[model samples]
Target: MKLINLITPSANLAELSSIASEHDLLLLRQDAVYLVHKAALPFPGKVLALESDVTWRNITLPASIRAISDAEWVTLSANASQNLLWS
Candidate 1:
């Protein structure tokens, strides 16, 4: 199943890794966007960050993290077979 994981806080990397699977998308927003600067997410799945949030916070998301527009975010969420929000 296509899973989308929305991370809104700074989650533990190990915890994330433990649950992560291939191609499970992870979207970072709010405080969680900070993770991109510190390090790429542990998950091997696709990683995206909210563009505006990163811009407003002045966090330069790394190359490993793709920046997604609002429309893209909606599309991603909508396409997911399951949506999991982790705060």
Candidate 2:
């Protein structure tokens, strides 16, 4: 499965949703952690946000999105078949 990393709040959600499969992992990092406050997320896949970033932004995460540590992020990326960054 693909590890899709979205690093900016302005990243194109339409394009992401179109290209992402249900089995892929969507990782929200950097400014993209702001997306957790949105009413809905576009991608229909497992969603994870950097815990450090979320805490830095003081954003409360919903139950749908998991908070992962940097080590976990590294592990996920290493295990995925492909890693894609969206900025």
Compare the candidates by lDDT and give the number of the best one: 2
Q: How many clashing residue pairs appear in each of the predictions shown?
A: 0, 0
Which residue pairs collide in model 1, if any?
Answer: none
Q: Write the per-residue lDDT of candidate 1 for residues 32-81, one digit (tens) a residue.
A: 88777564456778888889888999987667788998999888778888
Judged by lDDT against the true structure, how good is candidate 2?
Answer: 0.94
Model 2 agreement with the true structure over 1-87: per-residue lDDT tens digits: 999999999988999999999999999999999999889989988999999999999999999999999999999999999999999
Off by over 4 Å in 1: 1-5
lDDT of candidate model 1 versus the reference: 0.75
Instruction: Tell me each candidate's TM-score.
Output: 0.83, 0.97
Question: Where in model 2 is the C-alpha error above 4 Å?
Answer: none
